[model samples]
Target: MILGIITDCTHYTSPSGEVCTENHILLRQFKHLSAYFEKTIILCPFGKFDDRKVTTTYTSSNIQFHQLPLVGGNAMKDKVQLLVTVPKWLRAFKMLHRQCDVVYQRFPNNLNIPGFIYFWLQRKKVFATYTGTWSGYQGEAASYRLQRWILRSPFRGPVWVYDEKGKEQGRIRNGFSPSYSVAEWEEETAQVEKRKQRIENGLTTYKFLTVGTIIDYKNQLAIVQACHVLKQKGFSFQLTIVGDGPMKAELEEYVIKNGLQEEVKLVGKQNHVSLRQLYREHDFVVQAPLKEGFGKVPIEGFFHGVIPVINNISMASQMIGANERGFLFDASKPNHLVETLLSLPAQQHLFAGMINKGRTYAKLQTLEAWAREYYETVSAYYNEA
Candidate 1:
């Protein structure tokens, strides 16, 4: 039987007009699997948005986009899958099953129940890969509990996780053992590197960058408030917020209302070229997301030698690593962020050390490495079966 690999919400085209997904945790895993099943993989886009338009990047041999049904505008909740037409999803399912004997899907969200029902009824071998629980959605613990139900399902195959922490979180929430050993991940990309800009007036100002959308949960207001506090302390610095979302109007109002227009810039969403340039230009990336599954911003910022100043939550706390690689702050506390920023310039040498450490870390993870591991796992599974 020809081996067919299937994925949901895993492929993204880069800004350079290449069909590469965002190089976060799940994308890294998908890239690995793509290389492994070079010939038999079929990919589906289950994400809510696709800003870039690079459909041609899929390696021709195995890739397809099965548009996932979007739930209503509000934050996602349970029974969301019921709103979508199952027949359309089923057509994609049937197509995937017909092409290959084994199917692999990155799970959580609405696809869990439908995927399980389809594969079980068809008697197709299925693998459920869990990256992290859906924290972006509205409902709390019960939402995860519902997703975990499929994890314990008999049809669920080898569950792939990024780190032991990810596995533990899944197990704690779902009460299931990880079916396979986890893989090491790093955040490095071959995108065009931005030439470092020289800050002629040096050593006095602390510049921080906040990437991603200006959504409410991103907690950008906290950063602005912190910058205001830092400015009051005679600290000369700027906080450049990259990316745009619906919260733009509200955030702009807040910045103007507080008279922080000079100190904070709502630069709006930038393309990849500009984004890399932003990373190179800033001393560090500030991430204050209220919640995150696994933060790729910190890793991506570190990859470019920009230290990440992240909120103490989710994987950001674990990845910061004893403040050696980056700094973690209480996102809920603006004054704390101000204090950290004030203290950072004094540790210039330390910051340099962290950047060096980040460079070393970046080399350890590459597209080639990710692809190889995924291929071996799939090949071994099919071989044994």
Candidate 2:
């Protein structure tokens, strides 16, 4: 059967005849989906093809790319452009719907709205996976709210959300999982064992790692402040901030001004492979995001037996199994994270058990396992008719 995927993700072609993406995870998902379906059509906005900037490696013979006009943007001019261009894309989506046996759409995307409406109008079999926080949190874009409303409508088919709480709202489980292979897991496990030995012998300094784009929404500044509190309280720990964004410069300035240049380091962005190596050396993965959608970094950290210390938000708390699998802090309380960090060394011995439980949980949610779940869900719905 032909599987059509409607998304807002950009697709680019390299000058050397290679299909590439800036998002390695998305590229991996596409490759996995291609393996599951006989013919997979990726419908997305086509960006400028440049070999020089291409970073992600992904190419599949069974996968076909269908570029459409760029649909959503934040500016007023972009909205006007979308108004003038949507009709043309609507016709393209209708044609795509006619060729597909079933349609799968990524939610919280304005570009997917026209395609979703077209599928509904034609009574096509379609399912969606929501990629944002399912807690109905405020500050979400209007387009995202509209998309959620449409998916929750009775007329819509099965909708998958990343949080367990979403099940109460009629959303299915779309759990976040890591993409680590068995070999990688074994290697990371060895590193974790070595680190545990060092912790036991008092030969290691506590290492904290946070992986995500540096943005206001991610609340990296909160992590810095929390670390400052820990330092003032006489805690010897190092924080490594991964991923880069607009907030990097400001965060760097704060670090330098507070005499935390040595304690805090902004390492910019690293690929998945590099990140796995970095994860091996860290004791805990700390994140204080104001909002989160599944928070995959924690899951990824778990695979390496690194404990996650995250804010007590809905999706994050649920993913970490409400502190059963990892530690949770209240971002609202300034001293909460600091207290948690300061208390870690005294409780370091208990980390072995926590890491074991977390690793076991992460092992079950690999990319292959998730793909099987996704394929089964889509296949069941397709066979219903």
Stretches of candidate 1 off by over 4 Å are: 1-32, 38-62, 67-84, 134-141, 152-155, 162-202
RMSD (CA, angstroms), candidate 1: 6.2
lDDT digits (tens) for residues 188-211 of candidate 1: 233212212222224566778998
Instruction: Provide the lowest-lDDT 10-residue window in model 1.
Output: 174-183
Best by TM-score: 2
Please provide, for model 2 over 1-385, each residue's C-alpha lDDT reduced to its tens digit, 9 standing for 90 to 100: 8888888887777777676676777777767766888998888887787534426756588888787775566799988988998877787787778888878888778777777878888888877788887666887788788877787784366677766464544445555644665566666777777766767676347899999889998999999988888788788899999988899999999999999988999988887678878898788999998887778888888888889999988677666775667899999996898888888878877788788888888888777777777788777765674
Q: What would the TM-scores of all predictions be?
A: 0.76, 0.92
**Model 2 alpha-carbon drift over 4 Å, by segment:** 49-54, 164-171, 181-183
> What global local distance difference test value does model 1 have?
0.62
Give the Å error, residue 211, model 1.
1.3
Error of 2 at 123 (Å): 1.8
